[model samples]
Target: MNVLFLGKIQYALYRLVLAETPEAYLLQTHTLPSDLNFMPTLGNGHLGYTVFGDAIFMNGVYNGAGGNSKRARIPNWLNISAVVCDRFGCATDDDELSTTNDTLYEMDLRDGYFRYRKDYKKLGITLEQRSYPHKYFNRALVYEVVASRHATTARSNAPQFLKLSQHPGIASDAFEFVVLNNGSNAKGDYRVIRGRTQVLEFERFQPQPHEIYILFSQSLEEPLQIEWPTWQMEITHRIIICIDREQSVALKDLQDALELNFQDLHQKHIKRWHDFWDNDFSIRIAGNSLELWQIANAGIFYLASSLPSLTTNQKNEPFDGLSPTGLGRGNLEADYQGHSFWDTEIWMLPVVTQFGYDYAKEVLEYRSRKLEAAKYNAYAKGYKGARYPWESAYTGTEVTNPCCPEVAQQEIHISADISFALQKFFAQSADFDWTCDKAWPIAAEVAEFLVSRAACEELKQVCHFLNVMGPDEDHANVDDNVYTNAMAKIALEFAVWAGGMCGNASTELFEKWQQVSNRLLILRDVDLDYHPQHEGYKLNTEVKQADTILLGYPLRFDKSSTHLNDLKYYANATRESGPAMTWSMFAANYLRTSEDWRADEYFERGYKSYVRPEFKVWSETPIGYEGSANFLTGIGGFLQALIFGYGGLDFYRSGNQTTMENSGVLMPPNVEEVEINYIRYGDSKCRWIYKSHSSFMDCGYRKSGKKFEMLQGNKRTLLATNFNVTHRKGDPPIYINLMN
Candidate 1:
C-alpha cells in the first residue's frame, strides 16, 4: 500500500475551531492500509507502537545480536477491537461490516492523537478508533473505541452487552500471556527470540461505565473478550506499556491499576499537547493555505511525539535517544534497528533545542551517559578520546551494521557532530550546570580525539583529517572532507570556550585546539569559489544529501561569496535520490542568501516529493522508494527550513557570551507574514515576526504580582539577551546577546 497514515486531525466527536492553534484539516487515506502496522504510529520515548497498537518497540530494548539486533517487539497490550452489534448483528472485525473499505485516518495535532473513523453503511453504525501514546504519562498508550447506536436498534438480533474484545490468538511464540486474578487484567511477556524478557501490563476500563465483565483466556493463544451492558459505549484501553532496559517491571496489583480514572488521565494528556501548540513554541504564517501550516505542525508533532514528556522522572527509567523514525518504527531493521545516529545531533537537535528544553536535554543526556562507551569506542579505534559510533543502540558502542564496514571505520564526523550539538544547546540554554557536568566532559573528549586524529603539516601549519567519510556517504577514505573539517573546527572552538566557561580551562590545551582548528583544511574549489565535498572531490559530480552546504548554516563557516557559490554548486550536484533532508538544507541555505526565489523553489522541493500526501509524514526518500517512514531526520530538516530559513535566526555561542541573530528575514512568496515563537537562553520564549519590511521582537517575562516585561527595545535592533528566557510574540531582523 502506497498510503501515508498521518495528516491534519479532525475530531470525530466534535469539530472544534481552535483559536491561535493550527486549524485542523481532515486527512483521508485513499484506501485503508491492509495492515494497521503500516498506519501512523505513537511513541513516548519509552516505546513506539503502530497506530492500531499491534507491534510495539521500546527504547534500549534490543533482543538480538549482530546485524540482526533489533528492538524487542513486545506483546501489544493496547490492541483491542470490538464487533459493533446492532439489529444487524456483529458488524466489526469483518470487512463485510462496512460497504466501503475506505477509512478516514486523521490526527489531532492539538492533542497529539491518531484517529480513524469507519462507517458501517451495511450495519447502521459508525466506529471511531482514537489512540495516542501519552505525552505526559511516559509509559502509557491510550486507545479509545467509540461505538454508537440507538438503544432501540439493539433488537432481538443484538446481544445483551456491547462487544469489545481483546485481539485473540497470539500467533508469535515470542509472547506469553496470563490472565491475572479476577480476569479484569492480564500480564504478558515477550520472550525475545534470543531469550530476552520484556513485559507489558494492561489496564482496560470505560469512563461512564455501569457494568462490565472480562473473559479470561487460558493460554497465550486464546481470545480474551470483554462485554459491557450498554448499547453505546466509549471504551478506553489504557496500557502502561513500559519495558525496562535490563529487566522486567513488576506487575502491579489489578485493583490499583484498574482504579485509575481514564477521563482525568486523558484530559491531562490533551492539555500537555495543547500547551505545546500555544503561542509559545508555535509557528504561524499568514496567507499560507497550501497546507504549509499542517505540514509544519505535523513535523513538530512527530518530533515531540517520539520524545518523552517533559516531567519529573519519578520512575528513573532509561531514555536512550531519538531514533531516525522517532516513535514510528521498532523491531524493524528498516529503521536501522531503532539506533540513534548523527541524525539526532545534526538534523533533529536544532529544532528540538529551539522548542523543547527538557527533551533536548534528554537527547544530550543520552550521549553524556554513554560517554564511557564513546570513550571505549575511541580507545578501540586507536584514538585518544571519545568516539561516538556512527550507529548507537542500547550498548552505545559501535553497532554499525557489519554490512557497511567502510562507514563504521570512516564516518568519524559523528564525534564532532555530538560536541557541536552540545554547544548549540548551551547557546540557547546557558545551563552552566549542564555545561560543567555534562556538556564540558563530552566536548573536551571529542576535541581531544580531533587533535589526535588530525595530521598537521608543521611547515605550512595545515591540518588534514585523513581516511574520513563526509555526510555524503557515497565517498570513503577521503582526507579533510569540508563538512567534517568544519564540524571539527566548531567542536574544537566549543571545547576551548566551554572549558573556560565551566572551570575546566587549560591554557595549553586551549591553545593547541585553536592552532589545530585554525589550520584544519576547509578544502574549496578555488575555480568555482565553493567548498569541495572533500580532498580530491570533483565539482559538478553527484553527491548525497546536504553535505558542503551545511557549513553555511549549522556550522556557520565562511559566509563570503564562497557560501553562495557552494549553495548553487551543491544544489545541482545533489542527487534526486538523495535523502529527504537534502532539499530542506538547500532551501534554508538559499533562504539566507539574496536569491530568495531559489529558496522558495527548494522549500517546496523539500517536501513535495518526500512527504506522503495521505498523512503528511515524511519518508527518508521520495515516495515509491524504499526508505524509512515517519523519517524524523526529514521532519527536522523540514522544520529547519522554516525556523532558520524563513525565520532567519542564528543561535550560537562564542567565548562566554551566547547570541541569536536575526538578519535579512525572507518570507515565503505566498506567506504575507510569519511568527516563530521559540525557547532560548534558559527558558525565555522569544517571538520573531516579519512581514514585508516591518518586524518586531521581544524576550518577554513575567514578574512578581501581575506585571509582564518585554525586552527594553529592538526594532531590527540587538537586545541585551538574558540567559533566563520567556518568549512572547514580536518583530524580526531581531538580534539577542547574552552577556556574561
Candidate 2:
C-alpha cells in the first residue's frame, strides 16, 4: 500500500472501486483478535466508541473516574459492548470481516459514519451495520444493524440476537437491564435499556461521592424472538447509548434520545459535520495528493471531536477539557490517565482559536475554572500566585505519575505556557475587554509566580531560572532551559503590558517584571551566537526536540543570525522520535527565515511522521504510541506551518493599526502554487493564493465591523470597502498584492 494516499486513496485514485481495506488496518495489525489497540474509533467530542469488525468492543466517555479501584484513576468510563449472534449461539471472532469492498464496508468522512456488511454464505444470513456518534446530542451514540436473507432460496431457522453488553467494571454491583415496547408507535416500537454502576477516583482530591451510571438502549424497527423458524428478507435495529455520572441525568437523556427519530438524528449528524467543514478554515492544494487534503481535514475533525463543548458539565468532571490521549479507553494500565499537559495551551488552543472564538473562549474558561486549584497548588509548594500542574486532571491537581517527579515538580514552564496562551488569545482576538476581565488575572498571577521563581543576581544584572524542565522530557531537571526562560520573559512582559491596559498595573510588579524580562538569563554559548537548549547542553550535543528554536516561531523573538544558527544546530541534534510538534516548529522557523524550500520539506516530513497512516490523525509519536490520535498540539503546529509558515500570517498591533501582518506568500521553488481558502484569523476570513511570480491575499472581517489593514512585508495596504468589492455581510474581501 502506498503511504501518501492512505485514507482516501482508493476514492481518489479509482472511482469504480466500492471499498478498500482501511489504511489503519493495512499499516498496523493486531496479532491477537481481542487486542483493542488497532481498533477504529468514532466520537462526537464527548463520547468515543471503538469498532471491532461488526461489534463495538469498547465504548467510553470523558468522565473523571477510575476504572474499578481508587488508585487506578481512569478519566473515562468504558461502559458498553455489542456483538451479533444467530440462533445457533453467538458467532466467534473468526466470522469473516472485511472493509475493502465498498458495498461491504465504508467509512464516509463527509457524513461522519462507518458502515460494514458481512455475509455468512453457509448460514444463509447477511448482516450490515452502520454506526455514528450524534453531533448535536452530547450523550448519545447511534448504531444501526440490518440482517437480511442472503439469497431468494435462503431459508433458515437462525434468529439473530444483537447482544448488548453493559460492563462497567469489576468493583461495581449496581447493574440493571430492561426491555420496553411502545404501543403502536412506529418509530419507538421496541427498546431495551441497560444501566451499570462505576466509581470515580482522584489522586490528590476527594473521589466523586455519587455512583456513575452508564445507560444504553437498543431500539428496533422490527421485533424478533430468541428463535425464528421463518425470517423476513431484512430486519433493522437501532441502538443508542447515553452515559452520565448521575443516574437521573442518564435516564433523562436516554429518554430524550429515544424520542428522536433515527433518520433525523443521522441527518443532523451529517449536517453538523458539513457545517464544521464549511464554517471552519479549509485548505485546497492544487494536486492529486489526496493524503495532504485528507490529513488536514482529519486533523481539524479530530481536534474538534477531542474538545468538550461549553455545554458539558464541569462539576466532578476530570478537567472536562482536553486530554493528551483524548477520551480513549486503552488498556487499563496503558491509558493516558486523561491528563492535560502544557500541550493544551501551547500547541492545541492555537488551532482551536483559529477555527472559532467561542470554542477558544471555552478552553480558556476551563483554565479559569481551575484557577483556584492552581493557586492552592502554588501555595502548597510555597510559591506565589498560580503554578499550574505539569499533568493536570480533575481538580487541576498535580497528577503526574509518582515515578516522574521531575515532570511534576521541576517543569515550571507550565505556568508560563498558560500565560503565553492567554496572551496569544488576547493579541489575536483583540478583545481587550474580555482579556482584561477574564484572562489578565491569570496572566498577572502567572507573572507573580515567574518573578518569584526567578533569582535576580544583582551584581551580574541577570535573573536566572534554575533547575527547570523545558518541553524536552528527555532532559530532566536542567538549569536555564532556553525555552523556559524565553517563554517566561514573554509571560512577564505580557502581564505588565496587559495590567496597564486593564487599569490594574502594579508599580512594583511592573518594575520586577520589566527587570526580569530584560535580564532573563538565556543559556548561550561562549560566542553568544547560538543559544543552548539548556545550561551545559553544549557539552553533549544531544538535543531532545525543538527547544531553543522555539524562540523563533511561536515566541517570535530571536530573529537574528544567532537564531538561525541555533535552528541549524538543533535541526541536526534533535531526535527523530521526539514529539510530533518538533518538525513543524522547524518548518515554521525556516519559513520565518525565508528558507521556503527547507520549510516545505520539514512540513512534509512532519506531516508524514506525526500523522497516523489509517486515520490521518496525529498521535504522540510516528510509531503509533498510546497518545491522543487527534493530538491537537501537533495539529496546531502543522497548521502554523501552513498558515504562518507558508502564508506568512501573524497578528500584531502597531501605531493605531491592529491587523494581521503578512510577509507575503513564501512559496517553495519546487511547488508551482499554493492556496488556502477561508482561514479564520480573529474576526476575519482570509484567503491567500501564491504563484511562482506573484501572490494575492484577501481579508474579510464579519464581526469586528472594523476596517483592518494588511502589512505585506514593509508595505501596508488598506482593504477596499465591500461597496467597491465582493461583500460577505458588509465585510468586503480586501485584496492586496505582495509582488506588485
TM-score of each: 0.85, 0.80
lDDT of 1 by residue, 349-452 (tens): 98888776777888888998888888888888788889988888766777777689899889999999999898888887766787889998999999999999
RMSD of each: 8.1, 8.0
lDDT of each: 0.68, 0.62
lDDT of 2 at 424: 78
Query: Which regions of candidate 1 are displaced past 4 Å?
Result: 1-22, 25-30, 33-38, 86-89, 92-102, 151-159, 162-221, 224-257, 702-734
Q: How many backbone clashes does candidate 1 have?
A: 13
By summed lDDT, which 10 consecutive residues of candidate 1 come out lowest? 202-211
Leading candidate by lDDT:
1
Residue-by-residue lDDT tens digits, candidate 2, 199-285:
443444544333344454642333323233355454555666655555566566667666765455566666676666566655555
Runs in model 2 with CA error above 4 Å?
A: 1-38, 53-106, 121-126, 148-207, 219-232, 309-319, 329-335, 526-528, 624-630, 653-657, 666-677, 687-697, 713-715, 720-740
